[model samples]
Target: MMPQSFETFNNIVNSSPVLTDRFSALVQDTISAAREQHGVDLTIEDCTAIAELRNATLGATLDRDELDRQMLELSSLSDSKLKADIAAGDQEAMAVALQKVNAGKEVVHYERSSDDRARRISMARELGIATPPPVQDDLRSRAEKIELLQEVKNPAQRVALARKWGLL
Candidate 1:
């Protein structure tokens, strides 16, 4: 048998994709505090994890907008891969491809931040920490591969991200 509240939370998460970290934190914090107040032996790790999840989810939402903007810039500046491939035999095409490949590569880096944010969110949530909505598990799961993912946007995000990655 599962805890009713836990199951309720799962259902809420599954159904809502727009819950923000602030909201999730409020919910989780309230529940955890209640549990603690009532004599449920909660550890520092548990409290830390929930706090981290809330922070990570919030960070991911903030980064998502920036990532989307960067991606748009990359798309506007880079030659389409298909066009580059078609022009492969032409020196001009090759040049274009090279330029696009280089330019787009930089823009592609936006994923690093987004991925980092996602990973932090996922890890925190998975550990029974509360998380905000708009959390992308795929991003979080593979965040380790991204170099820029570790950059913290704010003090809260920084602490949460560190805890999510076990850096703190």
Candidate 2:
């Protein structure tokens, strides 16, 4: 059985506007089935209430606008003007930037507490792309082949694509 005091989880499931009663009921039934299969001591009442909570969250997901807004807010906090301020060496900007950065960190901590490294590498990889490398390989023929392959439209065209791209 799931934890009794999954307060946030409860709130998410209960309060979502998009989750219909029927869908919520189905999810509750599924949870109950899993519990019963595992010999969990969950009561019918627990499933009913948890189903309501879960429904609320699921319902909210039906609205794409809300999801988009939330994604925008998250991205804004993580990779917005605040990061620029920090890069420019401004102390006041750095303070504000740190707050934005910390806010993003807090969200990540809560949402992905179980898989910390998963998000770290992705974020680092994205940020690394904007920074220029030390050298510019202008005369590299390998880079040209890779670029040509990237432009190819068909699967067959790409099937025989060469691997000679950059300094090996």
Candidate 3:
């Protein structure tokens, strides 16, 4: 099954979205700790029930201003996740939100095929790596053929472009 939403993570009502890297160990530890402290073994589900009871007494009885502040914090964190095509205003919010995510993450790139041979040769030269000259085709270059076909209108020109660009 899919994981629970992050908004309900460790919630008093549900505990399905455990974000720990070692979830089984965390669950076992919670159960073990509860047994050690209370002299009764408590499963993860039982621990969740206790949390609900704790919220019933503690959260329900908070002072008005404190409750309002706490509710504001909870609402920000527990609101629904963003959609793919967020509204324009939300997109701006997401851009700011992204600034807080994955800063300085490393990225790796792999080499491409010889079709980019000309680009690679220039790059190697700039990096001071000795490189052999590129093997040039006797006929018109690929870019030239593509550029030549841009204004093509006649049916025969399409066939000519196809054959020249080897799309046939």
Candidate with the greatest lDDT versus the true structure: 2
Sorted on lDDT, best first, the list reads 2, 1, 3
Which of candidates 2 and 3 reaches a greater lDDT? 2
How do the residues 1-168 of candidate 2 rate in per-residue lDDT, one tens digit apiece? 556666656555467644445455655654464455443343433443443334444543334344223323433233543445545656676555444333455556466765655555454434332343435556757667677777989866575444223223
lDDT tens digits, residue span 1-168, model 1:
544544554455556666444445645654464355343433323332343333444444434344323322332223233343433445565554444333433444565866655654553333323233333345544456234445645778777665565455
TM-score of each: 0.16, 0.24, 0.21
Q: lDDT of model 1 at residue 15?
A: 68
Q: Per-residue lDDT of 1-168 in model 3, one digit per residue for the tens?
A: 223532354543244333333344444655564456334454444433333223433234424354333332332221212212132336554553343232222331235434345554553343223233344555877777667677688879878766755756
lDDT of 3: 0.42
What order do candidates take by TM-score, descending? Answer: 2, 3, 1
Model 1: residues >4 Å from true position, as ranges?
3-9, 20-23, 35-39, 42-168
Tell me which of candidates 1 and 2 scores higher on TM-score. 2
In order, candidate lDDTs are 0.44, 0.48, 0.42
What lDDT score goes with residue 110 in model 3? 38
